[model samples]
Target: MRIVDVCAFYTPHGGGVRTYVEQKLRIGPQLGHEIVILAPGDEDGVVERGPNARIVTLKSPRFPLDRKYGYFASAEQLHGALDALAPDFVEATSPWRSAGLVADWAGAAPRSLVMHADPLSAFAYRWFGQVFSRRTIDWQFSVYWEHLRRHSRRFDHVVCANSDLSRRLAEGGVPRTVTLPMGVEPGRFSPLNRDPALRARLLAACDLPESASLLLGCGRLSPEKRWPMVIDAVNAAGQQSPIGLVMFGEGRERRTILKHIAGNPHVRLFEPERDRETFARILASPDGLIHGCEAETYCMAAAEARASGTPVIVPDGGGAADHAGDGAGMTYAACDPAAAARAIATVLRSPRRQPQEARTITQHFAELFALYEDTRARVRMAA
Candidate 1:
């Protein structure tokens, strides 16, 4: 079947969604299917990934919040692309206007809302989480919940990349929520990718020796990431022992991160690694990763670390915590830097253990595509 993904969340320097779509492009053809991406870009064009996969870009203006991303303003162009492509299955990753567009599209193809983002956690809860309870936050964002419910009722299925997100959606009145957790590329990321020289260099920047514990933090440098909290936790943990944190990410909050890490020698922020090999090497070289974002739908960084035989410390809830199982890693209370510091110290004191099982992107997409086929079959039968 030919599948077209209408993605408004995709960006050139995106963290997880970009990685996922790229992986899907290769995996789809391997499964004897065609995959196409329709996204907003600075210009309109088509870029072929392979014989069965390609990206169709629609000319759009830069998104106001971040210049790295673009927003689709013209529905005519989007619908025109969908009409020309004529996909057998349509999937939308964004829960905003893009999902609404897909829902209202006059197409025969069975549509799926592959819920990749959690706006409630990413925005509302992140903003007021420290002040208001989650229950209160949810009540305040009733409009978004209703919006999701309306769009969900029109879709064949609502696929969530994490069980936590699926459960949340199901409870929030979105029907047909399926828990299909995403995965990493095991072949590309592994303990074998660890580079001793790289590790030493990063530690040296912190003015620390090889014996010091080197932690990593990654993702888009954004408000939702709560990077300032992570830096505080790392700083607190550093009080007792020599520890260094090397963060990889870039975004509008770069200056905030810089200010937070000012006068601190143990924490350093670096640009995200675009090269897969170099990224894997940098990821595996660290003793562990400390992620402050509790709102991740699927913490790809944690999963990649797990696949790399590196431990991870994540917030006590959400997908990141789920991925950081006992053998995989550990967790601390969300938004609690003191607790995070303790968790960091505890991880440093404990032994490192490789994850019992490493999940692969290939395995994940195989199941996802099979589900797509089944959903299409069911839709046809119902018709």
Candidate 2:
């Protein structure tokens, strides 16, 4: 079976969606399927091709609305590409302009749309007022949601990354909404592969002493991620433990966060690690991962951290709770810095029970890949 993944952004440009597509492409061939990715061109250049999958670049001019490193592709160009590929199945990550082209190319083949984030999540930054005004954010979300509601109807299957997204789709009257948790590459993230020297070097480079308990928060440094909360939690926790906070990822909120932590000696921010190896190294070295984001389809960083035998301390609500798993980590009420701080401290002082269990429980990704294989088989039968 041949599967074409349509998304407005791809690897080296996008986040979880990009990684998810790339993982599918890597593993699909082993399950007897070919995968192709279609995404917009960025300053970084077109995606580098690989054996299991080929990346097709669709050029689009940069615009103001393309704020979050996302771009809109021309429908005509996308249709031409799909018509040429004639894939057995089409999987779209977003129901944006690119998704419209996928809908247009629906010909007899089965198509699926994977919803990684709720359209309303884009509006989450409005409250912070550092990125976009409330009015502008509202308008952006309204437009995106309206497009998703209409275009999503055309897909044979619609997958939501979590139950919240599934509920949102259900409310919008979308048919065939299935909740599929995102999977992590355990091979890359396992604790057994941790490089202690690399971890020590990263800590030293970040000006953190080996004795300091490091708390990591990995994700786009955006207002929605609520990074300030993590900083505050670390500050509060510093009273108890010698805590150093290191955050990975770059975004519009970098300057704001930098300014917020100007006088704080305990916090350090670094550019997002593009290489998976570096990311896994940081995950394994961190004492615990902190996540304050109110909305997350699936907390890829938290999952990776847990998979690396690092406990995750996430907020109570959101998709992350589902991924944290029972006994894998601690989940506190949203934005409670004290709770977040306490959770981190507790995890650091406690025995290695949770991290050990995390390694055992996170093998669910194998089950998820089985589902992906099954989906491909069904598509082949229909084809």
TM per candidate: 0.95, 0.81
- Model 1 CA deviation exceeding 4 Å by range: none
Clashing pairs in 1: none
TM-score (C-alpha) between model 1 and the true structure: 0.95
Estimate every model's Cα lDDT from 0 to 1. Answer: 0.88, 0.71
C-alpha lDDT (0 to 100) for residue 365 of candidate 2: 33
Q: What would the per-residue lDDT of candidate 1 be over residues 196-229, giving only the tens digit for each residue?
A: 9999999999889999989999998989899999
Per the 3 Å backbone cut-off, how many clashing residue pairs does candidate 2 have?
Answer: 0
**Poorest stretch of ten by lDDT in candidate 2:** 357-366
Cα lDDT for residue 30, candidate 1:
93
Supply the TM-score for candidate 2: 0.81
For candidate 2, lDDT tens digit of each residue in 1-383? Answer: 67778767564566776677767766766656677777666542345456657777666666465554446556676677778878877778776666677787846667888776664654454354467774566555666657776787887678766776687667666777877676577567877756767665656755667887777888987777889888888888889868778888887888999988886766778888878787778788777888888688778788778878887888776677765565778888776788888888887886654455333213433444455557767867877
Model 2, position 270, has a per-residue lDDT of: 83
Best prediction by TM-score: 1
Local error of candidate 1 at residue 278 (angstroms)? 2.7
